[model samples]
Target: MKKIKLGNSELEVGEISLGCMRMNELSKKDAAEVIENALDCGVDLFDHADIYGGGESEEVFADAIGMNDDVREKMKLQTKCGIRKGFFDFSKDHILESVEGSLRRLKTDYVDTLLLHRPDALMEPEEVAEAFTELKESGKVRYFGVSNQNPMQMELLSKYLKDDLIINQLQLSLVHTPMIDAGFNVNMQNDPAIVRDSNVIEYCRLNDISIQAWSPFQHGMIEGPFIGNEAFPEVNAKLQELAEKKGVTDSAIATAWILRHPAHIQPVVGTMNKGRLQDIVKASDIELSRQEWYELYRAAGNDLP
Candidate 1:
């Protein structure tokens, strides 16, 4: 696997990390095998969110891998907070409470990184800063980041945050390229040029924040993956063609398409199947040429000016 620095932090994580979102779906033995497979594949970073499987995902992961220092030293843990049942909460109390709950379920003293799951419109940056201060001083979290946040949103928190925000997790893939679409369609009258995300990619690059690409193969948010879905026949045909040429799984081709970007994005593969996860991790070894990358991009129903 390819290793890259996580933002400005000293932590060097695998370019293709594993997201433990569906880990709760597996039994103890299956979860253990999945975790083992990832580690064996050189994936040291494990991503988790408190709301995944109603917090049972973390519990399953913790049970699968003991929380002792020896095991913890071999891997890095990153989890998210801020999403409540029906609303988003970033208050100091909620942040602290959520982290404590995660610690209890994860059976760890301090997670390597803690991300704000989603932007809370009513968030008080000062309160969050205070909570982060306590967490850092208490050694409960080593780094901080946000998920699904735009440049202005991160700027609001960065203004009051003493710690450097190292990551911004967003949805990105070959078929789903809103961030890329707006860039190329800047002067067009089409809806693709509407600038839904305010050029977050450039903003993140300027600030040196690592972009973590979630759902690298999914065509829509919370929808079926694009690999073999009939809705994306064009993309599937191109992916299969490339997979044959590259001698890797079509899933790896799908992931390598994301890794080819200079943004140095970390693709969070959330597959529970060990074989699928292994195939996806192999993307770190595959390199796509400029022509091939654009070919796959255009195959996904995107156009160039």
Candidate 2:
């Protein structure tokens, strides 16, 4: 697996990180096996959120890691907070409480990074900064980030916080790339495609904030699977062709297409299958040529100018 610096932090994480959302449903032994497989495959960063499986995911991960001392030292653990069951909370109390709960559940004291699960509309940046400060001072969290935030929201948080926002996790994939697609199809009046998050990719690249891509294989907002789906047959066909050419699996090709971008997006894969995890790490090595990258983009229904 390839390692890349996560934003400006001293920590360098695997280019392909494992998302542990589904582990909550797996048996403890099965979850441990899957995690061990990911480590053996060179994945060092593990992603999680507080709401995954009603907090069972973090507990399972804690159990899995606590069972193995050696594995605990070799991997970096990252989790998210700020998401409530029916609302959002970024108050200092909630932030501090969530981090402690996550730490107790993960069987670790310090998270390599703690990302705000999502943007809270009623967020007070000062309160979040206070919580982050307390966590950093107490050695509970080393880095800070956010998920599903636009550029303006990031700016607001940055204005009040002292620490560098290392990452801004976003929903991005070949079929769901309005951040990239909208820029190319500009000036098409009345076209919703022409109006998306205005230059979020450029903003992150300019600010040295790493982009973590969640749902990297989904065609859209959790509607259905993209790989081999009849709605995306053209894209899947091209993915298969490139996968064969690169000697990687079709899933790896799909992942590589995202990694090939200059923005340096890290794919947070949600697969619980150990074999699928191995295949995803292989994607870090399958470099797509410029034409191949564009071919997949076009296959996703974007017109070439």
Candidate 3:
């Protein structure tokens, strides 16, 4: 439970943050127990979203916080907006309304960070900037960032917005890391797959924007969990070997693979299992060497060059 300074923001957040997307279906007591476990393990950053479980996730997280006032003050809370069921909206009205709803749901006056859930094709940078300015001036949101945005989109927003873009949440995992893999196999003909994310990893790092990796243990986009999936037998075999060597769970090994990168990425874990949460916290301490890091990368079939 080490802390890292968020990009250009004075907020020091835990290296591993807890994602509450799945807690909407859990009982209030159970959700409270899970959040308590995270706090006990030194996890201080809790991630939420307005669209997760149709806004029930934020309510459950707020209930957990209400169970303990002292804990609420000790942890940093972050949530995302701008995603609706049918389309994306970054309108000034939507942003303002969403933050108000989030504050009411989380039972907090201000969020540590507020992210635009996804890029809206028709987003007007000026409207977004106005919303941010109003929120910052009103003391509703302390920091701002974006999720699933490329460098060009970020630059577009930065051009009109006055606040620093602090983070970019991206779908990154050991098996589905096209952002890292595409660069290695850049010149392969007949490979439209060779071009993905437009080198977002390097772009964010160079621009001083922190990268938060979501779905860190998934093999693909919601197809299934990769922790024990049979399709990735070879990958699981290597994970087991590393887990044994590091004296941590295979899930931790998977998380470590993401953390071992020099980009200083934070893994926003979506696990609800208390044991799994503890294992991920332990994974942060298991530093993989350069060779071991690439070993897992190659095992995951990313060694094109």
Quote the positional error of residue 118 for candidate 2 in Å. Answer: 1.3
Q: Root-mean-square deviation of each candidate, in angstroms?
A: 0.8, 1.4, 1.4
Stretches of model 3 off by over 4 angstroms after superposition: 67-69, 190-193
lDDT of 2 by residue, 175-238 (tens): 8888887676667654535656768888999999999999998877879779988888899999
Distance from true position, residue 251, model 1, in Å?
Answer: 0.7
Q: Which residue pairs show backbone clashes in model 2?
A: none
In model 1, where do residues sit more than 4 Å from their true spots? none
Deviation from native of the Cα of residue 80 in model 3, angstroms: 0.7
| Backbone clashes, candidate 1 | 0
Q: Which 10-residue window of candidate 1 scores lowest in summed lDDT?
A: 65-74
Badly placed stretches (over 4 Å) of model 2 are 67-70, 190-193
The ten-residue window of minimal lDDT in model 2 covers: 189-198
TM-score versus the correct structure, for each prediction: 0.98, 0.96, 0.96
